[model samples]
Target: MNFRARGVFTLILGSFFVSGIAGLVYQVVWTRYLALFLGHTSYAVIAVLAAFMGGLALGNAWLGAKADRVTRPLLFYAGLELGISAFAAIFPAYYDLVHQAFLAVVRGLQPTGILRLSLQFIFAGLTILVPTVLMGATLPALTRFVTRSLAELRGKVAALYAINSSGAVLGVVLAEWWWIPSLGLHLTLFIGAALSFAVGLVALILSRRVEALGDGVAPATVTSEPAEQFTPRQLRLAVVAIGVSGFVAMLYEVAWTRLLALALGSSTHAYSLMLATFISGIAVGGWLVYRWKRQAHTLAAFAVAELVLAFTLFVSLWFYDLLPWWFVKLAALLARSDPAYFLYEWLQAAVCFGVMFVPAVCLGTTLPLVSRV
Candidate 1:
């Protein structure tokens, strides 16, 4: 924690923050683009989404292993970011190719509903998995780069994740408010590419500086962390909790969006804003984790976070009954002061915050604590 070390850590956090923004930008836009190609049916949309997440899972599983093993984790992270930018640049063309391939499958086979769904998934997966896999690898690489020892992981990973999620909050805001609305999706893709490229270049430069400065830390020092002593039972429980954490988070997002749409309207703004609210809560929770600076009791903390999250989720169901009343009251307040549809943004946010923020924060807290394992 010397001056030089702190400076280097700041640079790394800054890089992760930038990457977080670019990642969410890509995700928001990708859903739009994927929906166009895959159609708007629930089944089709889910298929495309599953493909998107599957790629990330694949990357986390595969490259996460390589992250600590790599001699230079910054280089590994930079490569992933650069690869994401490169693939994003070409993704439109790649998407069209996949679309053509999908149509050929339909025309040639004349597949039924289930077969078509499978085909949609296959085609969508083929189109998106490359860049997303790279995106997924980033957290592991960046986390490894920041933590030179098992003990160093205590709050560091969560703080890094917080910075990243903070960027994601802005990313969602930018895409919704300016990027898509101003530049259109195609041009927005280029903007995202440029962001990825910028981060990659920064990382590459930092890597060289680390070499020249010696940095008081070897490039390979992360690999020298003492072995963990978690028992088989502890490891198994932690792994299960990680899976459950992801599942519950995803379910909350999907459910909250759908439920809110029922209360609010189905405008694109509601969807985007709800998503932003979710990420913001996560970002807040991450900050809380770093600020708490408590010991890392991965199992106990993870379990408590999950339990609180579940209770919150159940409590939210009761709150749904009150949304109608809340909206009516909100509308009345707006009506008094010369309301406009644009003003509904406030309403959307109030409703989203009411139910989602706390649970999302819990979702944020769990990952960091559990990752200590």
Candidate 2:
């Protein structure tokens, strides 16, 4: 299940890695599109993110059930990817209709203040949830295909997560730095859709030949609904604790991105760098967790990881205020030209990574580490 070596498992790993890349590409594309539609205010940004996250949560809860029961989870995953591709293919038309609906609702209701914001959130959520639900459902299917029982769940899930996150890092970089800059949005979307379709098609082909190895599934955890009742109080507490950690992790992401944007520029590219740096740390942390999965006293390891995560959060805060100082120094050095812009862009991304990387890693480690406990 490690899929570290060359073989069918390696192919599966690569497939999921590509899937992760496609998923993040869609996220970058969708977030940029929705931001343009809703306006780039703080509340608007949160609305877009909330909608995206909400849809994924819904998918994991609902479609995830199907993922659990399906004998060929690979096929289910293929179907989900194809569904996302289909949505992406039609998203341009749908994007236009959503704007029309937004305008119509505004004209009819003539709402103001909180009502206006609520309307924005509602429209933003509806606009994003369509494909994101399908996007959200992918991991559950992959997870079901990967492992069978609680015993095999720990390392395999952690490694798979790391692989997916690694792909996400590449996706963010490519979407923001390379694809959108060179190809433009609509074309970039076509590329994203194509990647999703390719992954699904490959998965479909693989599903026919390889059978799942695991017997029972302890599915990979994401931020979704509450877990079923645990007979043991300790188990219940651990589950709740991890849930809280995930909540706090999201708060950190939202807060950090909002703050970093002030220093990094609120351009679409800057947002992508912030996301990439964050996920990069997560990917590294997941890899670390996979490596250390067999440590004795798993609970202690989880607690220690949490403490490190908290400490890094404070560390990031200190670094956050220093970002402006670094930016100001660089501003004096650079000119308002293409080469300067290029230099400045990567410089700011580096600063973002420096501040965010460690904390995000700790945060990422906690999720899979908890499963070991």
Candidate 3:
């Protein structure tokens, strides 16, 4: 990449990092807020998570296909960011109105659990789908924008993933430790919206500047090959691998969270820490792939990483099985003394980190490797 292109790519990645933070902040705040109205149940968690992931999948499949067709990708990207901000700005009021209405009607009817759960899903889906979908389109749009050629694409994508995941880590930490606690939900929402809006403004300005430089043609179409370049077998394998990995990773995340709850207390603090540690592994893995630039060995590396991840996770299950015993021993030693809570929390954190960190890192590394392939 030329110096100017590199500079623009850097800016794009930085913008994405900020946007990632905004996205996670929205997830943390909105989920908690909705739970207040819907009541805390496994159904509520499933509804929220489904809405978030479903929106992303929709955006990725729909908008991603269109990203490469846009003449000014940054303009498109900026518009998407603005859309997310607009939704974020309005969502609080919308959700409150919807939740209250639903609660009143459901209370009058005294609905069954399934009916109530379905209603929660519908409300959560409606409240979050627009912004979350817009957030999802960002990866494909920004990836298409930053890398002008196929050769540079993988590295740029990996780097962007790294920075974005790092931003998520920061967001989770801040939301738990500072933002939600200090700013409260409305102000926190506005803050995230502002960051996203600022990113959109910056992208709009850059789009115009690039246009002024006479290289403003549809960037995404420039010398890019279609997926048909890969053989049918390879394409099928890729699809299968992606699906398997996603399913496995998500299942593992839920299992690990439950296990960690036994070690740590099942507070928001513990949940936030768990997410941060898991995502940090992904960020580190992406950064490693970007820095190493070893695409030739990506397939082998990915396979090895997957094996390592699977093995480590299985081993960690055994550790979890023994964790309660270990916790009791440690607790007895502490014996409700001063700093007992602090030390216990620290111990929980350490145990959680030790068990998941390596497998999560391996999980993270495999993603970029697969993307590279």
TM-score of each: 0.90, 0.90, 0.90
- Show model 3 residue runs off by greater than 4 Å: 41-44, 104-109, 211-230, 331-345
Give candidate 1 regions above 4 Å deviation: 41-48, 212-231, 296-298, 321-339
Model 2 alpha-carbon drift over 4 Å, by segment: 1-6, 41-44, 211-231, 335-338
Q: Choose 1 or 3, whichever is better by lDDT.
A: 1
Q: How many backbone collisions does model 1 have?
A: 0
- Against the reference, the lDDT scores of all candidates come to 0.79, 0.80, 0.77
Write one digit per residue (lDDT tens) for candidate 2, span 56-114: 88898899889999889988999999998899989889989988999999999999998
Provide the global lDDT of candidate 1 against the true structure. Answer: 0.79
lDDT by residue for model 1 (62-180), tens: 99789879878888888999999999899888888889988998999999888887777778778878888888789898877777776677658888889999999999899878989
